[model samples]
Target: MRRKAYDDLLAWKNGKTKQALLVTGARQIGKTYLIREFGGGEYDHVAEFNLATDDVTRESFLAARSADDLALRISIAADGPLVPGHTLVFIDEVQECPNVVTYIKTLVDRGEYDYVLSGSLLGVELENVRSYPVGYMSELMMFPMDFEEFCWATGLADQAFAMARDCFERQTPVPDFLHERLSALFHRYLLTGGMPDVVAAFVRDNAVDNVRTLQADIRRFYNRDITQYAPRDRRLVIQEIYRMIPGQLNNPTRRFKVGDIADVQRFSQVQDEFLWLSRANVALPVYNVDEPKGPLRAAEERRLLKLFYSDVGLLTGTYEKRSTLGILDGLGTQSGETSSSHDRMNFGGVYENVVAQELVAHGFAPYYFTGKKVGELDFLIEDADGRIRALEIKSGSRFRSHAALDKALVAPGYGIDEAIVFAETNVERDGKVLYLPVYMVSLLHRTRQLV
Candidate 1:
């Protein structure tokens, strides 16, 4: 599978002054696979090390005194030669041996061989290591495949995405046939998500049961990590918060309520627990902004927030297990068929989750707006021109705006000139608001550039 991060790896390899690269993300998102693939294609020899499984490799890092010494030990362990400018040295699962992180500075200073380091729970494990090579390493964040990458992996042609982009740029409706086809594909994405293994299973076998099984296995792996890595006394609290994600999203307000899971009266009691989860990349939280204005982060409401599962496929699997609904059976609705009303209602949360996931993947901090006398806006974003835009997400075709959006559009202090509504409708404009299908959320970055 192709990943957008591959291009970043290439840039790092060919830079004028290169430094060791660190790739960080949640587990099962393909960080290791991408680095290995890039190393194999771009270098003469690739020396790979896995600290999680090989005790000899971990011991070698502890014994080495200099960059040259470390290179010699890594070559021996990898059964390969580390030639200057000819070999790509990859360190996998480095978090398992956090002591080695600081040594990256020495290797980069030597500037002999290219280096790439990847790990899961990197931030959590870094806290245990005393010192870090902060200035000596360039960092890149990896995410589950975005919509366009998912299309490429699933056999969609480049022209298809180009057509969608053109439509979005011109603010024109896609041809009816293309719109239906993309909608069906988007629905499938909701079930399979961007996890490489889960998506590969669906593409190869076209079996929903297989996909569901894999999602459950991934969830189990995450559960095990919580037990293994979290502090002993807080293990139960972390698990409780993880299990309560789906229910918290179902609330009408959509802000995570600590009282729902435990008897805590103040968020301060569980603030660290939430931060731990966020750092692990298991949960994506959208902080509330009291006033919609410049520097959105300035007015953030830390206590009032919404939490979304990192992967939508996992969210759907958990929802199915709790509801006992046959969500997998509804995968055939990608051909313009309407899902049952029950399924539609269930998809509301899934739709919002995908929007949040895409926004984060595209380098946007998600924020929401709510007024006392007015209503709530689903999402708020700043465009390239420094104008705040209100985004409302609706799962059904009967989309409507609330007074809050109208007020924000004209409010001098708010500075929102345009509002966007994402729903199951064709592209159209209503006064200052533009209505687009939910799948077009992936094209938002390009649309912003065009504006």
Candidate 2:
């Protein structure tokens, strides 16, 4: 499947970067496959090793004394001398032997071969990989296939996006036929998600059941990771927190209350558990901001927040089949799944989750705004131009009644000029507000740089 990160790999390879490349993300996000694909085409010989599955090689890497010794050990394992400049030395599952990262700098300095390293759980596992070569590494964070990549995998034509972008900029409605079809496809994208393996299976079999099954398998893998990577005492807490994501989001406020996990538990007690999950890339927590400002992080209230699954497809797998049908058929606003104690008629949480995923993948830090006077906005993001914009997700038919957005527009002190209502409707603008289809969330993006 086509991925946006492949371009990043190509740029790293062609840039002749002296720094070794580090590809990091949650497991099964296609980190290994992407690197091997790039290395195979760009290098005459791609020597690959995985520390997770190969114990002897892991020991060899850890015992190496110098850059020359590291190269010799790798060549011995590869069964021959690696070509000086034509070879790409690829390391996988470096989380098992993080010292390999420290070696990356020395190897790059030798300039014998191009080096690329990748692993999962690095945020939690590699924290102690002492002596990290800060400037000697270029890092890339890989997310699940975003909607645009999903569109490409599912055979949606390129012109469709071109047309949508045109209509979005022109403030015109998409043709009725295209709008209806695109909406349906957007639903499919939500169910299948951006997970490459699941997306590929859906593309080939076109089976929702198979997609659900595969997504479930990935969730199970995540469960096993908790046992393996998380601290023994924190494992149960992390596991429970992961399972609670769906029901937590279903709440009216969509705020993750620590008390719900256990009546006596407090946020300060399990703060590290939440950090573990966040760093592992298993769950995404969008904090509440005191005020929507240029740097949204300044006002972020970490304790009061909404937590979403890393992928929406995995999220849907946690629910019953009826909820899935409700989403597909566009039956009503509420999923109406009554099996769980936290069940609700509202599907706003699911819609909010998808939008959150889209925003994070597009390189934006999304926050929710709730105030005594301004009410709650589903999402607030600071644009590249350093102005905050309010975003709302209307999953129900009552999309027109946006009290929060209306209030914020003229709330006096916020200085908010524009608000977007992402609903299941055609494109239109009402003064400072722009109403866009839910699928167009993929189009909300801008490039930014840090000082």
Candidate 3:
């Protein structure tokens, strides 16, 4: 998997006062595999349990009176003995029993063993639980692989992934071959969608048809999960929202409107479903950042909000756009014809989302910025140091948006340090603004030197 989250687990393991850890992500996003692979290799003895199975084990643990006693019983229930320094205890699907979170806090306070907890429906489960173990658990979010990680993991570390870090860091030109390959790979990623199994299969076979089959299987899993978890009436609304994503993004505004769902639908019926998807971690709602302040909350943005799926693959899978990749990958036609079609596909939306994915991966949650009278920026990322950087992504060859950048830079009392433009050419500064190619977004911290 080659995940950065694995490194987070390592830090928690070595901490002087480590808490019980919770690993959260969507189903089939490799939360379980990450823990097993990283834990098995790093620890002496790994004791794991799946709360979805074995009712007796659940009852026994829940019946315990003390955290120390519960830890001992959980170890015994897992068919292993607790060895504090040697064993790393893992609880999978802990959301099936949210009270276990309390027990985990007790274990952290009293027991000597290190613990790793993981679950897909933790968001929904948290709603049912009394309180979260805030101070007692370190949370590690495991999203689907980003494009660079996917490339490295699938034995296809092309020029794009290799140059991205350097492009943004040094503000240097990317090799021509790398840019072309990245453009191609960017299209491929849109189809395969960053699920580990799908990517592994795509790289192994080099067959788009096989990738489509895998995506369909994953889509089936998601549909079934929604049917089981979401309310019966709202299930259809959720499906409608999922179906509307691609077309909605194709709009110029890119903000989801209820009318975009179809010819006949009310926002009242679908808003709750949108919240449900957010709660299930199926989608991310990027609120408009009006104030551009610390902890940019929903209040900062009055009316605008955009929604994105957690993984592009799931988006493609659920939307039944598996054929879009065929046009993207230069397949099923004469060479010249395929080239023109590929160029027309204009991989912009996927690239914009890819940039968003990497920013989230780097520990910053991005918000979209727009104003009724002013203008719009594609992304606004606030770093740990309280610096809010505005990012504008342009996948096209032409560099526009200078006017919008000017408006954003001098809007009211906001201090825009320097704007970042991700495009094809490295256009030098316009006063304090910086123009960088899309390939360099991952390395923006280094590009900060230009500011």
Counting clashing residue pairs in each candidate, in order, gives 1, 1, 2
Pairs that clash in candidate 2: 334-345
- Model 2's alpha-carbon lDDT is 0.84
Most accurate candidate by TM-score? 2
- Predicted candidate 3 versus true structure: per-residue lDDT over 1-451, tens digit per residue: 6876677777777763747888887887888988999878898888888877867777776677766777668867866667778888898888776777877777777657788888876776667666677778887777787767676776665554656556655656566776666657655776777788888888888777777788778767767778888888778878778666666665555677876665546656566778887777767766687665456554356245677777776555544454454535433221112234542444445556667666765666778777765677778877666677888776554455555667877777775555888766553556667786554565543111100
In model 1, where is the ten-residue run with the lowest total lDDT? Answer: 328-337
lDDT of 2 by residue, 1-451 (tens): 7788888888877875578988888888889988888887788888899988999999998898776787778888884458988988889998887878877887898777888888999889989877898878888888888888998987889999899989998989999988887888888887888899999898899888888899899999999999998999889989999999999988878989899886436788888988999899988889998886657888898878899988988888778866566677443363322333232346678788889998988889999989888788889988888878899888877777888889888876785656999988999998888999999999988662211
RMSD in Å for candidate 3, one decimal?
A: 5.1
| Stretches of model 2 off by over 4 angstroms after superposition | 79-81, 334-345, 448-451
Report, for every candidate in turn, its global Cα lDDT versus the true structure. Answer: 0.79, 0.84, 0.68
- Strongest candidate by lDDT: 2
Query: Residues 94-192, candidate 1, lDDT per residue (tens digit)?
Result: 887676677777877877888788888886877776667767778888888888888898899889989988999999999998888788778778888
Off by over 4 Å in 1: 65-69, 321-344, 446-451
